[model samples]
Target chain A: MELPAQTFQVTRADLVRYAGASGDFNPIHWSDRVATKVGLPGVIAHGMFTMALVGRAVTEWAGSPDAVVEYGVRFTRPVVVPDDDQGTEIEVTARVREVTEDGLTRLEVTATCLGEKVLSQARATIRTAR
Target chain B: MPLDPSFVGRTYPPTAPYQVGREKIREFASAIGATDPAHHDPEAARALGHPDVVAPPTFPVIVTMAASSQIIEDPALGVDYSRLVHGDQRFAYTRPVVAGDELVCTNTIEDVSTRGGHGFLTTRTDVSTVGGEPVVAVWARYVIRGEA
Candidate 1:
């Protein structure tokens, strides 16, 4: 079965809320001063936080979250989340790479940040509903 | 500074079983903005042949991170938490994690090394049920940024 692609935007408030909820009180995600001091151009989002959004995109596309059997991603660049009108948006494109005899579908996933690849070499295996 | 090589193969005690719950899965899915019905409704999951609402793939991070504390808090490891950053993450799954499955994680420090003026630490956490049925294995790599 061919699945459609999905897009998502991560707002500044989203990053703040995730930091609070995940107990990852890293200053780089919320404080500009600390971020700049740490050599980043500005406050950057957590890599795992961004990766989690990729998982969301896949699950939402498959119409079932439990369908995902395996998911892996490598963070290549930091998503500079600015506190402004232009929110950081992630566009995820997924296609059915292959389907196995056991009812598992391999999904090739790509997540881009502001037109640049933030996550590379991403893939997921999902067991389809019979 | 050389890390204790003996720590490489040491496997920590298994964490207490974490019962997968529907509410928690929904919370995680919502946090990531996953609007899939199979993550929030048991009926939808049952229709898809799952026992109950299942968690998103990355949901294993919650358990793996908890298990990683055993390595992070190891005083002999001499890890500086403040300077560490997540480098990479990968997961291999044998099956989907369904609600009501009691899961435990056994964490092992796979490797510790220093190269090009940076320290790299890799840990693998195996998640399984009480009956030894494997669910997923999470591999996490962290890099300690060099201080000026």
Candidate 2:
């Protein structure tokens, strides 16, 4: 089974909010100057922030916030958040790889930005409601 | 320079307790646009059998990242914090974290590798109640870029 695609918008404001909430005050996430100096195109979203969005989609698909038993992802590309109002968008989709007799679902996840893959080796194993 | 492989399997002492706060959970859920009442309302969480507001799946990172820094900052590891980039993240949860749970983390260096003039380090953090009831295990991989 495949879950519906979910999309999320990431702006400089979102990055700032996430940084404050997560206490990951990495300047590469907010300051274009620091980001450019570090070799990024511009401000970029935190890898964990991106993973969190995908995690929301996973739980939503499982029909509960507590359904996730295992989740993992590799940051293959940076999702650059422009200083503009619209900023960047990330799209996530997942295919059910296995459904165990114990009501666990293994999903292979894909997240993309600007038509390019941002995460690889992404997978989640979730407990399903009986 | 590659990280010293000898450090693998080294487990650090448990970190100081970090009390999960409802406000923090609410803040994180709001930042991610997760509007589930279970994340913000104790009553809603109770209906779901949780003792308090439930944390989102990725919330454990807040605790584990801070805990893993013990290994990353080890002078013996020689990690260049500036060149470090997150390579991967993983979480395995025994249950959803709830507000007011005093959690402690025990961190371990899981792996270290080098390739293409870059260093790779992977750390695993086990989060549990101060009483030792396991909550979650987090794994994070960091890449230290070689000087150009």
Candidate 3:
């Protein structure tokens, strides 16, 4: 079954908050000067931030905060957040790849930003919601 | 400089215990815009059979990232922090982390290789309770780009 797509807005303010919360103070995520020097288009969202948003989508579909048993993703591309009131959007979509006999639901996940895939081989397995 | 493949299989000492707090979980959830009550309200988490406010799945990164510095900062490894980029991440959970749990992480270098002058290092962090009950295992792969 195909899961409903969820879009998340990521802003500079959100990145600041995430840096504080996650303790990842990488300048590439917040400093445009450092980011440009590092060959990024501009300040980019933390790859973990993008994964967290995908995790949120997974839990929303699984219907529980503690549903995940396994989750994984490859950071294929950066999600660049332009400096503006409107940051950027990450679109998360998934399909149920399989359901184990023991009630595990495996989802094949995808996340894209601005029409480019940002994550690859993204997958999550969750306990089937009661 | 390419990473020494000999570092593979090296295990770092366990990190100091980190107490998982309810408010920290809430803050992380809010940062990610995760509105699940189980990540905030203890009562709501207990309703879902958790001992306290549960953390979102990716919350473990906060702990593992700090723990993995043991490998990243090793002078013998010669990893240039400026040239590093996260390539992949994976988590396998035996149980979700909840408030009031004291967690410890032990980092192990699982693989190291150089391809096309770029170094790839894979590290696995085993997160467990202070009492030694495994909670989750997180794997992270980092790529160090060679200077052109």
DockQ per model, Cα = 0.62, 0.92, 0.96
Docking class of 3: high
A1-112 per-residue lDDT for model 1 (tens digits): 4566667777778888777655567899999999999789899988878888888777776656666777888778899998986668888888789988998889888888
Model 1 vs. true fold: TM: 0.88
Going through the candidates in the order shown, the clash numbers are: 0, 0, 0
TM-score of chain B of 1: 0.94
Q: Compared with the true structure, what per-residue lDDT tens digits does model 2 show for residues A1-130?
A: 7899999998999999999999999999999999999788988999999999999999899899888999999999999999999998999999999999989999999999999999999999999954
**Residue B14 lDDT (model 2):** 97
lDDT of 1 at A119: 82
Which candidate number maximizes DockQ? 3
lDDT tens readout by residue for model 3, B30-141: 9999898889899999998989999999999999999999999999999999889999999999999999999999999999999998999999999999999999999999
Q: B26-132 in candidate 1: lDDT tens per residue?
A: 87777777777888889988887888987778878877887798898889998888888888898888877878989999999999888776788889999999899
Give the winner by lDDT: 1 or 2.
2
List of clashing residue pairs for candidate 2:
none
For each candidate, what is chain B's TM-score?
0.94, 0.97, 0.99
Ranking by lDDT: 3, 2, 1
